[model samples]
Target chain A: GIQVEQSPPDLILQEGANSTLRCNFSDSVNNLQWFHQNPWGQLINLFYIPSGTKQNGRLSATTVATERYSLLYISSSQTTDSGVYFCAVDRTLYGNNRLAFGKGNQVVVIP
Target chain B: EPEVTQTPSHQVTQMGQEVILRCVPISNHLYFYWYRQILGQKVEFLVSFYNNEISEKSEIFDDQFSVERPDGSNFTLKIRSTKLEDSAMYFCASSEDGNTEAFFGQGTRLTVV
Candidate 1:
């Protein structure tokens, strides 16, 4: 099984601030996704970057597959961004497609 | 955009009782999954279904738990005997294939007493 670990378990940021969240995996993965669990408990997909870099609006993510690490960047954050951000991965060796999830980074963006 | 939809946003059941959580994934998606998240805990994978059969499951998905695609547009997770620990937000997800981005539903909050 692949282990997914996230850093900065807790974060409090002022609105308009910027933050970076990191995710490290123990093994190579073919499927990696970033999700935001909102206050209401709806899991929203932020990015799907198994490798390389991708940007969506004020949020962007970069994954260095060779190093087994991924980074998510949130710029000019807003209060709506307050929630738990999770990183999930599925190992390349197994095609089961079950994602191993990180504990998540709880972010609180205060206005 | 098409999104996964789950029924009975919240369910309350007595321990030792049976409960069935239902979900309707995107029409074109082929892979379906069920994940659980305990209060203040991370999401954990329970099972994945494809081609109308179970593809993979975790240790947490014991004999008490089962999944079925009873129809073309519906996927379900049934627990034979609910336990206190079974209380959690159960999320149903789907992807086009084994190697694609998966989308999750709003989730069903199950409370077992």
Candidate 2:
């Protein structure tokens, strides 16, 4: 089992602001994913970066495996971005490939 | 894009009653999983199914819980006797293989009283 830690457990931002969230894992992982839980409780896939970087729309994520950390960036945030963002990882040694999740970072975006 | 689909977006059951949550994983996916998130808590893995059997399960998934792929397309989680603590958001997910990214459904909110 791997341990995941997400930073800045709570965040509040005005619309159009930019922010960055970080995830730190305790062990080497074969899979890492970022998810956004919307108000309706849908877990939307944001990124599946085990390493390297990726961007989609206003969201981007970077994973530095050597450092055992990942970063999610929100550029020019919108009110719709308000929700809980979670980072989950699959340990390389774990056979089942079940993800271990971190306590999410709750973001509140105000208009 | 292919995605997992869960039935009964929400459910309410009396304690001690049996409840089954259903899901349809992506057609091409071979790995299926069930995860739970209690209100204000982090998501936790419950079980993973492949080859029509459970490959791994957490301590949270005990004797009272079971999973089945009753058909080619349907995967279900059965709680024999629900308890108050059984209430949570249950998410069904699937991946093409054990090493790939798993996609999750919208989740079913189960309330046991």
Scored by TM-score, the top model is 2
Per-model C-alpha RMSD: 0.9, 0.9
Candidate 2's residue-wise lDDT over B1-113, tens digit each?
78899999999999999999999999999999999999999999999998999999999999999999998999999999999999999999999889888999999999999
Measured by DockQ, the strongest candidate is 1
Candidate 2 Cα errors over 4 Å, as ranges: A93-95
**What shift in Å separates residue B73 of candidate 2 from its native position after superposition?**
0.2
Task: Classify candidate 1 by CAPRI docking class.
Answer: medium
Measured against the true two-chain complex, the DockQ scores of the candidates, in the order shown, are 0.74, 0.71
Q: What is the overall TM-score of model 2 with all chains considered together?
A: 0.98
Candidate 1 residue-wise lDDT at B91: 96
Over the stretch A1-111, how does candidate 1's per-residue lDDT look in tens digits? 889999999999999999999999999999999999999999999999999999999999999999999999999999999999999999844455789999999999999
